[model samples]
Target: MTVPAATEGTANRPAPRQNKRNKPTGVDILVLVLTIVGAIAIAFPFLLILINSFKSPADYNSTGPLSFPGSLYLDGIVNFWERVNFPEKLWNSIWISGTVAVFAVVISVLNAFAIGIGRIRGNTWVVLAFLLANLLPQEALLYPLYNMFKAVGLYNNPWSVVIIFTVIQSAFGTYLLASVFGTFPKEVLEAAALDGASRWTTLWRVIVPISRPTLSVLLIFFFIWTWNEFLIPLTFLVDNSTQTVPVAISVLQGDRLMDVTTTSASALLGVIPTLIFFLIFQRTLTRGITAGAVK
Candidate 1:
């Protein structure tokens, strides 16, 4: 019935001390401050755009860029949308960017497979060629491209922009993916080969499944890049109905002067779709980043 000396003392021991509020260290406070400032820095532009997007010219003139609007104004947005033929522009962008993303990823996969996994002779030169191609300025190619497309009767066509960007974007993708595939687990490739998988079969069923995250990230990047591309799209898609959002926005600016609010609304509309796309696939991008860090 009697407790041991150690057990008896345990019953009488002071209750575990409650957690105390620890004042943040200087380092912690500095980090907190930096994070707040960084967030505000990043978010301020979007906030400004959203605020000004809702302001009428009168409200914006009265209060300026920093101030919030007194009343919501949807007119600028609606007017810009209609004026720009936004629905057509939106569809054009989606089609071009989507097509470029898919084509670029597929081209990249094929190129990377040849240079990296296949370890074909002269792959270093091939990869270097890809890198150099990416470094080549769009400006340098413009006149030549224009002449070529015009000769082919494809000038001012959306497909011209599509073809140009698909090649351009895939060049970068090939360079990046070749490096990734160069470090691919050799064991897996050997396993697939040992299983009597043909080279084509191994690439699609084995390599692609493993590389999906990276390809997803590349696809998203290619889509966003193509969506935001101005020069080629503007050059190749002269008609209002064929223009992408960026080209339309630029055309809107050059063709007429815009009051601050209308300009802000136009910019906001341009930014929202890509921002939404990024947010949607952000987690996949994160995974792709870390996939290399671990097994």
Candidate 2:
């Protein structure tokens, strides 16, 4: 049992390499270039706004909209902040959006838990109804909602906005959370049941802890949606003092139509909260989206 020297040498030699084929092709390069160009094009307007937000009125008017500012200016933002009564609107938006986020998350989690994990009878039909409701345009429901709120004396109330946004946002939140919870581990739920844990206990202690990523996503979404909502708030909270940031900023535009710098500055200020919120929870948002996609 000894091999010949030539056979031994050949056996010891490395195997021939397989073709490496992971390099980018022309199509991929073209796609990358196009994507970059499209992103820049999309971002161009926002970039212009940001640049103009720091420019003086004279500079903004004298220079091209896309030109650099002669100097950084805070007068526009200061004047806009004072004129718009930013504090009052910011407070109104914070409370309304916060309430909506909390209530929506709670309702959505409960609905999703029952429909997704409990597997209650006729849940499919309920989900179908939600999908249909989601498909309905907001404008279609606006007049009815306005009339109903007016009849109930909620037409000029911040709480009205809170209630309306909570209900509207919860539909989508439940749909998203249901998809995630439906894929939960049945064994874990069964073990909880065998331990004599109540459904409420299991949901609060087990399911909720495991579902934080999805919940974070819903919370951020509801906050941003409510904060940015203009139509509902404008329709209901007609009192300028009670208006949210978006409505107030819009009013600033009409009142100061000639002042582009002030308008741009206010617009930039209005979006800061949402941008900061997303940046803070971006990791959880990514996880939630990936989890949903995988399921």
Question: Whose TM-score is greatest here?
Answer: 1
In the range 222-278, model 1's lDDT, one tens digit per residue, is: 999999888888888887788899999999999999888888889999999899999
Per-prediction TM-score to the true structure, in the order listed? 0.90, 0.88
RMSD of 1: 3.3
Off by over 4 Å in 2: 1-21
What digit string (tens of lDDT, one per residue) describes model 2 on residues 1-295? 9999999999999999999889998999999999999999998877878998999989987996789999999998998788878989989998999999999999999999999998989988988877787788777888998899889988898888888888889998888788778989999899999999999999999999988877887898899888888887877888889998999888767765647888888888898777887898899899987865674
Q: Local distance difference test, per candidate?
A: 0.92, 0.87
Candidate 2 lDDT at 280 equals: 88
Worst 10 residues of 2 by lDDT: 250-259
